[model samples]
Target: MSALLRKIMNFGPAFFAIGYTIGTGSVTSMIVAGSTYGMQLLWVLFLSCLFSGALIYAYGNFAIVTGQTALYSFKKHLRFGKPIALMIIVGVTFGQWNSLIGILGISSNIIFEMISLYVPSAAEHKYEIVLAIAVVIIGTMYSILLIGKYSLFEKILVMFVSCMGISFVLSLLVVHPMPAEVAAGFIPKIPEIAGGKMMVAAFVGTTMAAATFLSRPLFIQGKGWTMKNRAQQRKDAIVAAVLVFVISGSVMAVAHGALYHEGKRITHVLDMVNALEPIAGKAALTVFFFGTLAAGLSSVFPCMLIAPLLIEDYRSGQLDTNSKQFRIITGFAALLALAIPIFGFNPVKGQILTQVFNVFVLPLVIVGILFIINNRKLMKDYAAGKTLNIILGFALLFAIAISVNGVIALAGQF
Candidate 1:
């Protein structure tokens, strides 16, 4: 490839990473975090984004250097026996299953809300039809991936991210949050609650899945990055991290200003969009819907693709794009994505569950990545620096605390 083309290709993995983060679950999670806690949990978002980015960089660099995906590297280089690898595989697979369900559920809800605007008569019983539509859309996404072209998917994801970014930023502008309050949100402070414990748990759970840090290495590997191109990979990872932070922060700012300030509560993405309609007018509402739709669809593509790759890697030691197991797992995931809407589960609840699952899974994945990236045999000169290790170690601890608290909160709700 020419120099210019190669430079552009370096962006490929970042776009893929964005898709992993910006999906249906992500948008809904951000909305929940913003509406429920206002800017109180904004620090978690920053911490999650920074920590995840660091891990992504480490694992991406590892993959590029060693020419192996994170999972494969873990199996080959880690002292842990096959049992540990099996456990990781099983855990990751289950996590993906929950993620798929949640993504499908939220995406279906978005579609249902968007369509309900046109046909108010069907608003009450449209969920079944919405689920069917979601399935068809997921199938279309799968067909696009079956062709095995990253550029096409990357371009589409970039476009979606752009639209979503513009919509949320515009919404934030319309709402115009108090600069002081917004600034305060950036400060690390826990929210005040009667007991403080539940509030802390919700705060942690809500921000836990800021993005899928574990999947970044696999994405980087798929892009064919190598150690010789470590600089390029670092650039790509940085780009992705910044995008995630900006987009998520924009959503929170808009919600904090538009919804929380007005004492408005949002249980769905449409609620967030509808809240903007009065202030920003119908055009703004339309933009919000379009942005959200794009976010949902862009996420569907990666969830369908990467979840299956993780599953297949767990079963076999390699990612054979052509293998029957790979195709079957992808097909199954796509089907589940479609089925989520059909079941008529509350999208908000499903999104919360997804975040909670990520909270639980994140610590394990972080520990694994930290271990592998720091392994002398695997990283050699590139082993995680002391500062990075300390940061990651604290991040893992935070994730564990959040995961436990989230589970307790969920149990309380039940």
Candidate 2:
């Protein structure tokens, strides 16, 4: 590739952000929200992505200006920040591990479904097919991270995002949802279902994920973005936020139009895939699965990276994909996730666990960023201004509210 082409191909930090946020967590949350409540909660979806974007900017801008990763800043500034940062690492790592099962499970299921479209016999060996697909997907991710540089990972994720974006948008076109209903979905109204409150919290938590913010600084630093790249970082952040909104909204639109109107239910993630058979035909079913597969793989790659990156941040270590410690940590996460297929873990329970941990972690992370940005000594002239503080304040409140709701939901389960 030429220099110009390579520069364009490199994309930016936002691409990684998009790749991380638009994964299985976003997909599963959107699917549940759309299927169960129709578009009554679309307003929340919009807000989640918007708030997430703002937080990404706040976090990304901090890293760019200070030349420090988030965890390091936390450790340096606040007295108790080290423990909090460690907590974030453990919470995010464990949460993503639980999420890995569902992500990999859903991804493998879609691949199985796509193949089963032609090979009817493939239907009988569902477990084996899922295992094969999971192995291949995780194996490829391990190889990439092991042999490739951050640039290679970014390039591959860009392709994954593109594939998911195109497939989802095209599938939405086939669904041909009503414009007025979609518009009205923007009007805020809470659902009164069984898990309505938790679902709403899940929607918000999943979109504005804790791991995404925690991972931002490392990704930006990897790209060599410093204070000089602030303008480009802002531009990249905006574009990434928009892509997050579009991809997530497209999936919800397809689900609401196809599943909700038909009074269908989503008992399993794969159920959504099979449900697509009649609404948009086999071609769309294939398209949706491929899109889902792309989303899954995109997410799995970053989900695996979090543990190692967290360790890097905690130790203030250099990036070393070939390091023994890094490989062991990453490998542990990958292996743990693979157990989902081996034991046939419950996807719903895994999702609930992931969301609960996410809600619990969200507020702490927002506060960490808030503290970093508000620290005059640390941020100096780059400290968050009034307008930005107001945005973060709302986000902080939102996260707290969601966390509370999640707690109540968990308590009720007991």
TM-score of each: 0.89, 0.95
Candidate 2: deviation at residue 259, Å? 1.0
In candidate 1 the C-alpha lDDT for residue 68 amounts to 63
RMSD of each: 3.1, 1.9
The sequence of per-residue lDDT tens digits that candidate 2 reaches over residues 198-251 is: 787777767787888888888887788778888877777778878888998999
36-96 per-residue lDDT for model 1 (tens digits): 6677767777887777677668767777766666665656666773555566666555655
Candidate number of the best TM-score: 2
**Model 2 weakest lDDT span, ten residues long:** 346-355
